[model samples]
Target: MKKFWLSLLSIIIPASAVTFEDNDTVVLLGNTVIERAQKYGYLETAINLSARKKKLKFRNLGWSGDTVFGHARSYFGPPKEGFDRLKSDLTELKPNVVIVCYGAVAAYDGQKGLPEFLAGYETLLSMIKSSASPREIVIVSPPPAESLGAPMPDMREHNKRLALYSKAVGKLAQKHKLQFADFFTTLGESKGLTDNGLHFTPEGYQTAAPKLVEALGLSLATGNQLQSEHARKLREATVAKNKLFFFRWRPANETYLRLFRKHEQGNNLKELPMFDPLIADAEKQIEALKKTTLSLK
Candidate 1:
């Protein structure tokens, strides 16, 4: 059974592109776009089903409002502290593949901020390479903002800036010889894709998931397959796993748990690692479901 899946993956994944091998751990890192994906699970589901890697592990390390500078991740400390935290998490996870998506919030700064954004992005990539040393890095251009009429505020100008940033991202990917996923261009101004011209709705993620798989040079899973019972089970397991990880990494009342105020609730710190086994168990469930789904097909 394992050999069958391996052979299928080899056939589906283009040799010229980055590939996912069995047991490869993939970490999704970025801003609101990446972070919110965990809630829908469509993107992860598509990747898993399309790649057909039974043991492929996924970790969502997305931080809402995050920048290449790690501002959202900084918590109560300096931006450097947030950046350090990102490095630390990557080092701990030691993923085989890292998919990075940014440029949304940074694009708001427009032309004046372009240079700084690019520089920060370069530094962030270097940090990932030095810290985690992943086998492959995939840079994803931020998805374009939608233009819902009336009360949604026009996003045409913002999308223009986004396109500029996306172009820069593509060039960076080419220069570094890395795989690039251009959501900005692929998902340009779709109706019902975004709720407020920015964040994706569930249906939007469903629409974008196949595009992501295509951009990564992998075969696309059919809508029927994605909606199947086994697939739904897999997605549920994926979401459950992501929630466990989120709590493990970003616990409630962190200032009291493991920071300066740790003296008060630090005793609970030992409970953090307990989620590791739970996450592993959830992955096992996902693996089993993948096999069951494939066998049915």
Candidate 2:
């Protein structure tokens, strides 16, 4: 099994591609596209499998409806507060790599919002640099929106805006000397990738995972390998770990747990750290699963 796995790795991941070091923590920051990734675990699984020999940690800090301003993450506070939370999370996670995924939501405003989007993204990158001081930062362009025919309104015009945003993202990556994952160009218009014209379905994530791995300069896993029982187990373990981390960071009743209304359950804050051990346990499971070989048959 070990020999088989190594042989597969050699073919998929090139020696020149970027690779994670032992104990490296990678944080994913963005909006719905990123947040939804946690549910499927395809991206995380692919990355982990590619670096099976190393112990890597992944933290998904994605929020639905979030922007470069961190608006959706703000909760009851102002957008600035959301930005603060982002900094706080980065500080706490102390990631070695930070992957920033924005621009899709911002592209919604079209030409009218491009400037502000870029400005906000610049600020967001600066904040990540200062707060986390990660060794590497990756900027990911959102995948192109699909046109699912009649009822699902054509997204060609919107995709044009996304293309503009993707180009800007590439420029930013170059300016900052960071890595860029241009999904807009790489993934293109693949039918059935998304349920609607925008959001990815589970299969969509599966399809995009290798593209992400490739964009990051890592080895690409074949669909058959990714669908193997071994891979499924690893992905399931990743999803479990992510769930624990999510509840730890964003408790359902945060208003009572850590906010102004915390007087009622502030003491429960101690329970938050309790999730650390459980998350660690889940990660252990993932690590163990990573060593197992996928059954190509």
Candidate 3:
């Protein structure tokens, strides 16, 4: 009995590798690479299915073409406003884990932008830390674009610069003692997975999901048909909840609701609070599913 107890203790608390705790709120932040994940639900599914001992909440805050400075998130305003919004979002979410994904698009600027890129990344980190102190921050390298046999018009050179950025991301992770995941090296040669050599096809996300979990030093449950079915259901609920949150946070018709041109359609603002209940209901369903055992068999 003593031996059994000791074994269980070691398994419960491993010395190395980052681990998520019960009820940890995880937020994924990045550009199109991360934004598109909402449609596929691959990564989110993997994380939820793998998290055996905990109930985790996830919020995806991905903006297509966004940079480290929150450029894409800024709607009819300066980058600083966008940055402020990012900070506000983080503050509101109060996530326990934040997965930072960037570098690929910024690499488009080439070697000349490396310094600025890193500086912006560092500033972003500062903002996250300030808002969500004592949180687990995982840095994920942008996956490399596929070449489809011959290098496609500067694609080779783009990948070369991307490698540099990936290296820098790894270094940053080490410096901060944060977790690091390299999609560039791991997701290499994504021939059919990508739609246009860059964005992932639905199948691509399915393939990359497990890799993301592994890169983070997490384990996946031995998924079975039953588990898979349940995962699908739970993921669908999660996606619904995320959508509600999105509307609440960044409404589509913000111009009239909260921005400069509000007088005309300001009454529509009443609809915003309606999402809260829907989001809450979806979350409840997710939590209920989490309580069930997700055994492979």
Candidate 4:
């Protein structure tokens, strides 16, 4: 009985210390945008769907209601469960990329603004870059919220700040050479947002997912391995919505997005196998993606 108890302690202690370590993981961090209530960030469903649709392995690490600015309080130090979870994710998961969607939770706090947000966010990126498992970091701006809802004044002002906020996001990404995504701009106005006007509608996700893949440098056709493993988990989960036309791809024609579309529609995989050597080269990468999403509990 004593030995069994000792062995249990040995296992439990290390389990408590476990840190995420898969390199291909795409860690999604944020508040309600990524909570179970909202279905893993409004963008998660589609991105996860994209992972499965393209057969990419993927994992999710988002906590609902976590304001990025507030995460330190909610996630670590005195030890907010979410913060503890995030530390575990960073120490053990070791994802290839960590995409963060935050700010909305703090939008009403009246303290954080574009510059303050940028400075604080830069620190977070610097920490990740300096950490044991340096990763590809992606910054996502908060989506626009309903104008007349809870904390009514704050919500009304939120959309007005989108452009200003997006500029900061762009500048920060430029400074750090990271990818930037504006859920606000992407899902703004014409996208048919929810009644609340902030949370995206099912249609909103369909609109946002492909663009996220483009911004994150995932092959639309091939998929980014950053989100791997859970591809088959929700293959049949479909939500209905209207399709909205989007603005043209600006700046770089972006090979990742372009190549992805081709891969998505291609149907000659069997014939390609005839070029076994080339196929082997391509598959080495696909196999690598599989390893990224394999761990995350």
Candidate 2: residue 29 Cα off by (Å)? 0.8
Candidate 1 C-alpha lDDT tens digits along 72-110: 898787879999999999999999999999999999999
In terms of TM-score, the best-performing candidate is 1
Question: lDDT at 251 for candidate 1?
Answer: 95
Between prediction 2 and prediction 3, the one with superior TM-score is 2
Highest lDDT scorer: 1
Arranged by TM-score, best first: 1, 2, 3, 4
| Range of the 10 consecutive residues with the lowest summed lDDT in candidate 1 | 8-17
Error of 2 at 120 (Å): 1.0
* Local accuracy of candidate 2 as per-residue lDDT tens digits, 1-297: 999987534333323455578999999888999999999999888877777578899999999989999878888877789889889999989999888889888898988998899899889999999999998888888889999999889999999999899878877777777777776776877778999989999999999888777767777445467878888888988998999999998999999988999999889889999999999999888888887743233
Candidate 4 similarity to native, TM-score: 0.55
Worst 10 residues of 4 by lDDT: 240-249
lDDT of 2 at 211: 78
Q: Rank the candidates by lDDT, best first.
A: 1, 2, 3, 4
| lDDT of model number 4 | 0.48
In TM-score terms, candidate 1 sits at 0.92
